[model samples]
Target chain A: MKPDSPFLDLETAPRVAVSIDGAPLELPEGANLAAALLAAGVTVFRHTPVSGAPRGPFCMMGACFDCLVDIDGFTRQACMIEVSQGLRIIRPRDLGADDVDA
Target chain B: MSTHDLIVIGAGPAGMATASKAADLGLTVAVLDEQPRAGGQVYRDVDRVAALRGDILGADYTQGATLTAGLHHQAIEHVPGATVWAIEDGFRVSYTRAGRGAQIAADRILLATGALERPMPLPGWTLPGVMTAGAGQILLKQSGVLAKSAALVGCGPLLYLIAAQMVRAGTPPVAMIETQTRSDLIEAARHVGGALRGWPYMLKGLKMLAEITRAKVPRYPGATEIRIEGTDTAEAVSFVHRGRAHRIACRTVFLHHGVVPNTQAARSLGVSHRWHAGQSCFAPRLDVWGQSDVTGVFIAGDGAGIGGAKAAELAGRLAALKVAEESGRLSTDERDRQAAPLRSAHARELAARPFLDRAYPPFAGALAPEDATVICRCEEVTAGDIRGHARLGCLGPNQAKAFSRAGMGPCQGRYCGLTVTSLLAAANGTSHDETGYYRIRPPLKPVTLGELATLEHSAPDTAE
Candidate 1:
C-alpha cells in the first residue's frame, strides 16, 4: 500500500534514508520523524508496558508523549525530532530486549 | 547560578512578544523554548510554512512572520531546544539543552507557555486513527500532510477554521459533526452585543463557516451520541444529528472541543490558579500587571487564560511595560502612556470571548466517556476504573492518581488531567475546582539522570 502523504512535490529538498525497527525507509530531510513514520504506514508507535495496548502519535506536538521511541540508544519524543540520515530507530519493545551496549 | 534581568518560558505569541518588548525597553531578556523555532503552537514552523506553503495556511498564519522577526533583536537572547525541568524559589530555573544541564536565575520571570486542546475523551478515542483536530492541523502545518479522508468531530471556532483550511487545501473531510445544540445558539445570542465590540472576530468566524458551507462539505449540526468505531483503528464515526442516527465511513477521526491554558509550569512553581467559569478551565490568577502571587513571577497570554494570539501579543507588551516601570526604566506616567493603546487593543481583542465561550462550551457529556473508554493513554486506565476509585472515596486527582496510576506517566497528565478532574467531580457531586487538579511537581518534562549529572555550575553573577 502507498503511504498517505499530502506534501507537495519539493523536488529540490534533500531525502534521507533511515531504519525503523530494522525496516529501511526514505523521508524528506528535516521532516518531523513522527509525520514521516506515519506517512510510511508505521502506525503503532509502541504498546504500553502495563496493559500492552497499542498507541501511536496522538498529538503531533510534544504535549502527548505517545510517540516515544528509541533513537539510537536514547529514548526520545519522535514528534520533537527531525529526520536525519542513517538514523537507527527502534520500537520500545525491541529496545527493551536489546542489550544496553547496543 | 547565572542571573539575568528577565527569563521568558515558551516562544509562542506571548513569550516572543514579552521578550521583544522587554528587550526593546532596554531590559536584557532570554527566551527558552522546547521547539527549535520561536513560533509557539499557533504559529509553529511559521518561517518554513510561510516560505513553502503560504497560500494554503492563509493570512492568520502569515501574521506570525512579524512576531518571529521581532525575536531577532540583539538584546533578546533566544535559547531554542531547551527543556526546562524545574523552577525554584528566587526565580531560579534549571533546564537541559542538548543533553547538558544548566541553571539560570532571573530578577523576573514571565511564563507564556500557551494552551493545549481540551481533552475530549470519547468511545474509541484510544483507537490508532483517532487524534485531536489540533494535531491534524499541526501535521498539515509542519509537513504538508493530510489523511486520505477523515471525519471532523467536535465544536468550537477552531474546528470550523481547520475544516475551512482543509477545504482550501483540497482535502476537505468527508463530514463535519458539530456538537453544539440549538440552546447554545440562544445562549450565545445573549452575548452578541458584547461580542460585536470585537467585530473582526465575529466576521472571521462567519467567513470560515461560509467557506466550509461553500465547499459543499457535509455538516451534521446538533450532533450527539458521537462514537468512532473500528476493529484495530478508526474505520467510521457514528453519531446522532437532529434526532437521527448517522454513520459515516472514514479511516481517521479528528476531535476537539476547545483549548485550555497549559498551567503545568505555573502550577509547579506554586502559583495559584482559580477555576475560570466562562472558559470552564483552571487558570493562574494574576494582577493588573500580570504578576502572580509569587514575587518576580508574571504570567501573560493564553497560559493565564484563553486569549487568542492578538490579545496575547498585546498582553505581553503590557506586561513588559509594567516590568519596565517596576525596574525604574519608565516613570509611572510614561508607563501609563505607553500602555494606554495596548490596553484598549487588548480589550477589543477579548470582547468576543464571552460569546464564543457560551456558544461552544465543551459538551459536558464528552468529558466523562463510556465505562470502557481509556482515560489515561499511557497507563491504559479506563474511566470505569477511575469512577470505581472515586466511589471508594478518592477525593481528588492526586488521590485518584495514586489509586489508578492515571497521571503517573511520561506525558504526566497533560492529556488526561482535565478529564480525570471532571470524572472525580461528577462522582463526588462537586464542582471541578472543589476536586482540584493534579499536584504537578518537577522535573516538569522528563530529564534523564545522566543529563543532570553533567551540570556545569556557573559563577554567582553571570547569566548562562
Candidate 2:
C-alpha cells in the first residue's frame, strides 16, 4: 500500500531561523545547525589550521567531530546540535589558509 | 573477574567456531554477543524463513545455528545485547548491560564482531520507507512483516539473496535493479570459475537468482539514477538504463552498496588499517592468522574483510590455529598441518571476490550524489556544501568539517562521512582514504549526557 509522504504531503519538518557567525539566515525548523547552515548558504562553517582545508560533517553522528562549529562560543557538532529560532552561531578565525580575504 | 581461556565477542559462525575449537582443546571458553539469538546477521531470524521451516535460513547459517546450539551445551556463557565498549590491557573487556556497566577479562580475545551493511545515500534516503537491504531482512526475520510491494536496488550476492528471501516470504518484489554491468558479470563468471571448488555454495546463490527470475521480477542491469521518491517519505523510484527511464512504484526500497567492516573496536585499539578501494570500506590489516598489529588481539570473519560465510568460518578456524601455535599449545608443524584445510578453503572462497568486486563496482555517479542531495540526513548537509568547501582548497575531511560543518551531525559522520570524503577527495585531487573520513572512537553510539555524567559517580578514578 502506497502511503503519502510526510515530507512531501505534510511538510512535517519544522522551520527554524538561524544565524551563522552573526550572519542571519532562516533554516528549516528543527534542522541541526550545520544542516541549517548548509540550507541557508553558509557552507564554510569553520576553519582548520593544519592544512588550510574545507571541512564539513563527515560522520553525521557525533563520533566524528569533523562537523564542529562555534555556536555562541561553544564548540558543538552541527549534526547533534539542533537548530532553533534566534540561535546565534559564531565563525572562528583562521578557518583556512585561503581565508586571508575574509 | 572469572578467567576464561577464550572470550569470543560474537556468536556468529566465526565466534561459534572459535569457541568450539578452543573448547575442544579443553580450554575454558566464553562467547559474548549482542544478539538475542546467534547466527549474527546472515542467519538473522527472518520470520519468512522461520515460517517456511528452519532450512529457509540457508544451509550455511543453519549449520551455524546448529553449531551455536551445540556451543551452548558446552556451557559457554552467552551474553546477548551486551554492548562491549572497551578492551583494556590483559584482555579486560568493559561492556554495558541493560542500564549498568560491567567488565570481564579473558586469556585470548577473538573479535568476530561481524559487519554492517554499507550505507549508500541518495536524495530522499532519510525518508521513512527507505532502508538497507540488511534492515529489510531484519524486519522480515523479527516481525514477519513484508513491504507488500518493494524495490530492490544494488548488486552482488546479497541482491540475489534478498530477492529469493522476499519471494519466499510471499511478498514478491516489483522489480530488481542491478548496478552491475554486463562486462562485470562476464568477469565475475571467470572469478566464479576459480571459486567453483566451492561450487555447491556458488550454485545456491545461482538458485536464488533463478527463483527471482521465475517470480517475474523485472531485472535491470547497469541501472543508474536509482532514487526513492515521494517527498517526505519514499513512494517510488525511477532509474535510467540504456537511455530509457523506468519507474517502479513501491512502498519500500532496499539498497546495498555491499558490506563494510566493523572497525570501531579495532580502531579504538589503535590497530592501523587501510581503505580497501575495491570494497570501498576500511578494513584492518591482519596477517594470515588474523592477528592485527596488536600482539594478542585477533580479528576474523567479515570484520577482516567481506568474503561471505564460508570464507569467514574458515578464516575463524585458521585464526584459532594461529592463536594455538602462538600460545605454545601446538607445534609449528602441527599448526601448519591443522590450518592447511582452512587455508585451502579460504583460497577457494576468495577466488570469486575479484569478479564480485568487478561485478559490483559502486556506481560512481551514485557514490557522488548531487550537490543538493542530502549526504547527512541527521544534520541535513549536502554534497554541494561539501563541494563548495572543496573549491576553497580544503585539503582534508577535518578542514572540510571546519568550513562546512558537514561531518558534525548527530549520527557523527556514520552515514555521511564516507560520502563527503569521496566528494572532497575528488574535487581536491586527493585519495579518498588520504582524506580519511573520521577516526571512530568508541562508545560508538550516543550515550545520554545524563548517563555519562553519572559514570564518574560510580567508577573509582583510576587515572592516577
* Model 1 stretches astray by more than 4 angstroms: A1-12, A94-102, B459-464
TM-score of 2: 0.77
TM-score of every candidate: 0.96, 0.77
What does candidate 2's lDDT look like per residue over B224-258, in tens digits?
88777875345798899999998888866778778
**Mind giving the per-residue lDDT tens digits that candidate 1 earns over B134-167?**
8888888888777768789999998998898888
Best by TM-score: 1
Query: TM-score of chain B only, all predictions?
Result: 0.97, 0.91
lDDT of 2 at A72: 65
Error of 1 at B462 (Å): 16
Candidate 2 segments exceeding 4 Å error: A1-102, B46-56, B73-75, B187-192, B402-410, B448-464
